[model samples]
Target: MTLSTVNPDFWKGRRVLLTGHSGFKGAWAALWLCRMGAEVTGVSLPPEGNFSLYDSIKDQLTLNSNFIDIRDAEKLNAVVKKSNPEIILHMAAQALVRRSYREPVNTYETNVMGTANLLEAMRDLAELKAALIITSDKVYRNNEDGHAFRETDPLGGDDPYSASKAACEITTASFAKSFFNDKGIPIATARAGNVIGGGDFSEDRLIPDIWRAAREGESVTLRYPGATRPWQHVLESVSGYLVYLQALAGDDGAHLPKSLNFGPQGGEVVTVGEIALEVQKAFGIDSNWSLVNSAQPPEKSYLALDASLAHKALGWQSKWAPSETLTKTVEWYKAFSETPDIYSFTLSQIDEYEDIS
Candidate 1:
């Protein structure tokens, strides 16, 4: 269940093309790859927020970062062709649910077409050994049932964001079967749970919203307090992807599963209200939340993932429990608020995670 399966030597001098390296999860992956001594080329738009993990570490790390949209097939293909990456990790997408509702076209273009563009671009790259397309646990159909979704669960989504990711799963699978399989290239899709961690300044997310409310000394708004999610640290999810990629590197397209779920253990599944309370406790702040009584866009009331396939296939499992995940998140924000050197603080957290995982 630990990160012993991640071989550091396997990444040294490896050519890796990472899309969406400007986002929260992508930044963490970029840093991890850099730490492993991988020759990394990051492609994505510039960081959206003023304070971003990508901005914090981009100057220090040796990464060839390109500011381009994944939806642009021409530009994406050019970058992919030039990099000639052996491994491609596609993380770029319109990730926010609320934003997806507001910009459905953008969501589909970025998540669905963006995935197709990445796969299409890979067709010319004869050097491509493997590719891991990052999708969401929301890709699974949720009927408000409490059952944890496995990799075989039917792909469905009610919201724009989830639907786009579900479409991505289908797109990746089609590409894998129709193209990559014949070319001896292994391609897989990773469905990870609701990821929470440091350096996430994104809007609408529970942790970031709570942190912002607390800092402003205002009550936080809860859209779906009773909604339950399978939560895990950023490191846990990133480690799962790394382990899955490593597995794909050696295997042919025949044996590897087309899709794998990477989520926390059973104990880590918790309600939104419970996580809010946990974050308040961790931050030593008085709990104040106001429920949105108005009608809003529909979202899954309950979501969890069964990552048994990843555990059995790649020897990967979540390391931190939900409580520790919240604690570490609070600590990171607190450190950033108090200290000027966020770069060092973020690196220390990564080092600590590796030590224990």
Candidate 2:
């Protein structure tokens, strides 16, 4: 099972509908697809904050941008009908755990029903060949047992965000069984671990917090410093999605995996505190962290994913090692500040990644 590198020939002139095109991972996916010559149509809410990655690179992306709430079924359906996309990459959702706690209704309405809306919109689109729903690694029924989760593990979520994603997985499965599979549309879900990369300035994330604190000459506060997580570069996870999507495009639904995990290999366990130190060192700064917290929400203490399924099925393995992931991610942020032409600089990184394969 040799999973080939993403083929520009396969993506060239392909019609793609990418949801959540303004978010961190969505922006990266849009960039990659646009570079590979896909006719991309993006559907997402406006990118927020003063330093949104999508805003910085939107001018560089050659795609049709549609600002619509996924929760609004009618509008989303209308957009999907007008675009008539062949492939749908459903990445739109309320993705923050802390935010989910505060806005449970919005989280459920978006992550759960929002996903349902996308599939429902595409129910009759004969042009749609395949769809890959992006979910999170936190969907497992983790009791801090220190065992890495596999595709068949029991799905559970203590938090609103993870629970909604788990529900999304179920919704996607039901749609496939009831409609899409019979229509020969290959639908699959990918559960990926935590990703660290450049151009991500979201609040409450480790890398952004470290970068912000260092810029202000302050110490980063860590609420879950002792927790262990499986972390990889954002490119690793995104590349896995593209490769998996390519496979689905070439195959029928029956024999392929319905769900899979994209994560780091074994022995990549790194704690939050360790990551903070490593990121600081990568940025050429001293490690300064505070272990104090005020009303930090509940999260998993130990999280890992067994990606052997992705390897054995698609022959996909992580390209960048842990240290290399840290270095390259830091390099991107540094270049974002120093390099005036951030678009070319970002594309250069993508070119470098493709060259690695």
Candidate 3:
């Protein structure tokens, strides 16, 4: 049951409506779809700091850019209705956990209610073939144990952001059962572990902070020094999402409307200290990264995902090992800073990913 790599013609001329097209993962996914020849309509807020990759590739995409928040149901519905997209990839959310501690209300509203708004809007859309809602691996209740959280495990979260994502999982499930189930539009939710990649300018994430500090020749600060997590490059998770959609569309009854986690194989779980060491090796930097707040906050102890379901069901397995993940990520940022045709470089990566089969 090996899954085939995505066919470029599968996306050729397909209508794709992508939310959060300005964010790191969203921008990458949008560029990938565009390179596959999809007509992309990007809906997102203006980039806060640097120019988004979506903006960099705007001229190359047949896109209708919408500057609107997903929390606004009216605007969300209008955009989806007007675009009349064939595929909906909902990636917009308040994604930072530490920032959630500061803006709890905004985090809950965006992750939970924003998902609700997206589902409600697409309920009546006749043209939509599939919808993939992105959640986080933190949606599981963490007991600080070493057990890998399964999809059937109880969904709970200690912090605002994690809880909001958990709520989104619940909301998506309810919507699928109550509305989208018998309506022919396939709705699925994806919960993947922490995604590390280039082009991520967000605060409170490890890889970007490491990249920033290394680029400036400074040491990085770590909050949870000993915490272990299932880390993979962003493309791993996004590829899983695209594969899930392809499975749903091609087999019709092959995929159930349930939540799935995309992560690396067993034994790939590495601690924060180990990853920091790897990043230092990758960057050719020899320096000490300070550990702050020795007394750990209420963070997960060990988090990983069992991607066997994805393997057996979709024949999808992570191709980029941890070292390759780090190498490719760091290389992208370095190249992006100097590359004149950034869009071509970005699209070229998508072409490479698609050609891997």
> Backbone collision count in every prediction?
0, 0, 0
Best by lDDT: 2
Q: For residues 1-357, write the lDDT of model 2, one tens digit per residue.
A: 665587888899999999999999999999999999999999999987888778988998999999999999999999999899988898998988989999999999999999999999999997888999999998999998989999999999999999999999999999999998887889999998898899888878999988988788887789899998889888888998998888888854457898989888773679999999988887767757888758788888999999999898888888888888898889989988798888887788788888885
Which segments of candidate 2 are over 4 A away from where they belong? 1-3
Question: How would you encode candidate 3's per-residue C-alpha lDDT over 76-128 as one tens digit per residue?
Answer: 89999988988888899999888888899999999999889989998888888
Residue 90 lDDT (model 3): 89
Task: Give the best candidate by TM-score.
Answer: 2
Sliding window of 10 residues with minimal summed lDDT for model 2: 247-256
User: Model 1 scores what on Cα lDDT?
Assistant: 0.88
Q: Which pairs clash in model 1?
A: none
The true-structure Cα RMSD of candidate 3 reads: 1.9
Which TM-score value belongs to model 2?
0.98
Deviation (Å) of 86 in candidate 1 = 0.4
Give the CA lDDT, 0 to 100, for residue 59 in model 3. Answer: 76
Whose TM-score is higher: candidate 1's or candidate 3's? 1
